[model samples]
Each structure stands twice: as structure tokens, then as C-alpha cells.
Target chain A: MNRMRIGDLTERAGVTQRTVRYYESIGLLPSGEREGNGHHYYTEETVARLQKIDQLKKVGLSLEEIRDVIELYFTDTSEVLPKRKVLGILYRHLADTDQKLEALGQFRSDLQSNIERFERWLEANERD
Target chain B: MNRMRIGDLTERAGVTQRTVRYYESIGLLPSGEREGNGHHYYTEETVARLQKIDQLKKVGLSLEEIRDVIELYFTDTSEVLPKRKVLGILYRHLADTDQKLEALGQFRSDLQSNIERFERWLEANERD
Candidate 1:
């Protein structure tokens, strides 16, 4: 696997340098390997990790929440410790997803009713 | 109708003073009526509006998005102009809610399978 510097990693991952640095600072990403030339380099794995983080963010997971489950995507699932830890995280995320699903469902219903109400009004008011 | 100050409004609405001011600034909440002693007073309706905005926020609508539909809750929906505008917003929100529901459903399935995988691993490894 080829190694890339932070600039290349961010470009490939479509994230800002600050995001990469922040993830590293917060222990969400591993510290980049220091090269002999005093430059930090990352593996292709880091690019994938950054992209995965963005995907999780879109699904409404916080950085802290992602920390609980990010390993599942990248770590060897055959490992025992992370699997147990991730099992707990997975259960928690399932509950959160259910709650979000309920709220979104309710909001969808409200939107539908409002849309129907508006359409009825327009039909009554606009003679066609 | 009894008019209350901003303090009462936020307290009843379960939001901060800054939230009230911000919503007012953004036209999500109507500006509080100016009182005789230079104090800003709001009606019961303002409290309901603030509470409604919080509900929309919980359902993941941005402030700008809320601005589009908040009036539907407060204004007379019989009016033609706002009805047309909100019809567009309601349709957009319905589409967004469907997308969210689909994504959340997918994530829920992924989590359930992961949980089951971990459970199977633990069961096999423990021999209990």
C-alpha cells in the first residue's frame, strides 16, 4: 500500500486539513507516521477512514459516537476485545436509529398532512 | 389575552433567551411586541411558536428550513400567498424525511446484523 502525506490524504478523502488534524488530536485517527524528512505520512487506510468518518457524520453520528464503532469497519472482526466493545456500541446505535426513525416518521406524517392541506386549499381557491 | 415578557416566553418554551432573540432575528419567531416600559413582551402564541421551532429542530430541520414552514403552524393557512410558499417547503421536507427514514432503516439493519455476529462470537468463544 502506498503512503501519502496529509495533503494527499485530505484531497483523496475530500476533507480539510483541519479535519484530519482534529481527528488525530481527538484520537479518532491514528497519529500519522513521522518520516525521516520530518514529514507525517498516512496509509491508504487513513483515506478510507476519513471517508468512513464522513459517511458516519451524514448518518447523524457524532465524532464520539463514531469512535465507538469506526473500528468495526477497519479492524479485524475476529479480534475479541474490540468485538465486545463494538457489540455494546452497536446495540446503542440500534436504539438511537430506532428513535431517529420514529421522529423522522412522525415528521414525515406532519409534512404529508400539511402538503395535503395546502393542495386541498389550492384546489378550492384556484379555479382550473 | 395575557402578555408576558421574554423571560416568561423562553421559560414556557423551554429555550434560551438567546434562542428567542436569534429566532426573532431570523424571522422564525415574530419580533416580540414592545411594551410601555421599553420591555419586550410576547403572547402565548410566541411561546407556542418557539416550542414548535424546537420540535422541528429535533426532527433535524435547519433554521432556514424551519423559517419556510414555521408560519404554517402560526399563520392562517387560509391565506393564499404563504400557502403556496409552504407547499413547496412541505414537499421538500417530505422528500427529505423519506430519505432519512430509508437511511436510518439501512443503518438499523446493519447494526442488528453486527450485534448478532458479536453475540454468536461471544457464545462460541465463551462455551457457556
Candidate 2:
């Protein structure tokens, strides 16, 4: 299979070329091989790695944490148990996200009530 | 009516004294009167002001924007109409927050699917 260019990899991953370069610079992604034309070429695995990074980011892992996890996934001697431990981390992240969502929901409800109160005050003042 | 100390204000507001001081430093809150003993004293209006700040913050307005809004509320020549306009800005913020929440929800579902896929891979590997 032909190696994909950086642009192609970014398009396939649904992320901007800038984001791809940033990921590479931060070591969250491997640097692509440079061709004689100064263009970077990525292997098929690049897309999967990008997807994993995106998944971890969505679950609120910092780039550093995601990098550590990726390194662990690749270099760890023990695979199954380590993977299970990573799953536990993901579970905790999910729970933390749920709690944040709940807090935001409460904030939203409070704001709605405040808005209603303001409206009522406006109406009451108009009557007076 | 007797004036309250900073601690009392924070306790009543369900926020920390440090947060209150931080708010004051940022000019989102007004500095209280300094007594001879160096303690700050707050009038009942301080509680109302803190509540207003909390309400704006709940709607995700930045401290700077909240300060501008508060200044406009207090000093603007035109009152009712400007208050209505501020409410419009708040409505837009609410919509933006709702969109973010929906996007986060979609990300959560996608992560859940990825986790299941990873689990299936583990099961398949164990079988082999």
C-alpha cells in the first residue's frame, strides 16, 4: 500500500493539518517520514493513532496523559492487565465528565430561573 | 442593620473567602470597607452583588464581561432597554452551552463504542 501524505492523513482523521502537526510536535503522534520533495508521508496506522488520540481527548485526558497511555500501550511488557488498567482510567474520566455535566446542568437551571426572575421584575415594574 | 465580615459573606454565598477576595481583586466584586482592626465589613447590598456575580458566572460570562455588564447596570443612562439587551446576550450564551453539551454527549457515546471494540479485541485474543 502507498504511504499517505500528511494532508491525506489529516483529511481521513477529520482534523486540521495544523492539529496534526501540533500532535506530532507534542509527540502524541509519530513524526511522518520526509520524502525527497520535503513532504511527509504517514503509514495506515497513523489514522488509527489519531483516532485513539481524539478518543482520549474527548474523554478529557490531557495531551500528556494520552501520550503516556499511548506509550504504555505500545511499550509495556504486560498487555492485557495494563489495558484493563487503562480502561479503569477511562471509566474514572467518564464519571468525572458526568459529574461536570451534572454541575453544568444545575448552573443552567439556575440561570434559567434568574432569567425568569428578571423578566418578572420587568413585568412588575411596567405595571407600576 | 449590622454589617457582616468577609467570612460571613462567603459562608452565606456558599463560596470560599479566597474566592470572594479573588473576585474583589479582579474587580468583579467591590472591595469592602476596612475597619480599624483591618477586617473588611460588607453591607447587605454586598450579598446581592455577590449573588448577581454568581448568576452571571453560572451563565458562563467571563469576569471581564460580567464587570462590564455590572457597570452598565449601575451607570448606564438607559436602564430597561439595556437590561433587555444583556438578557439577549445571556440567551445566546445559553444556546452556545447547550451546543457544547450536545457535542460532549456525542463524544461520550463514541468513546463508549471504542471501549466496547477494545473489549471485543481482548476477548478475541484470549480465544486464540
Q: What DockQ class does candidate 2 belong to?
A: incorrect
All candidates' TM-scores? 0.80, 0.60
Interface RMSD of each: 1.3, 4.7
Clashing pairs in 2: none
Specify the highest-lDDT model's number. Answer: 1
Per-residue lDDT of model 1, residues A46-102, tens digit only: 999998788777678889988888877788788536556667778888988887777
Chain A TM-score across all models, in listed order: 0.85, 0.58
Quote the positional error of residue A45 for candidate 2 in Å.
Answer: 8.7
Looking at chain B only, the TM-scores across the models are: 0.84, 0.57
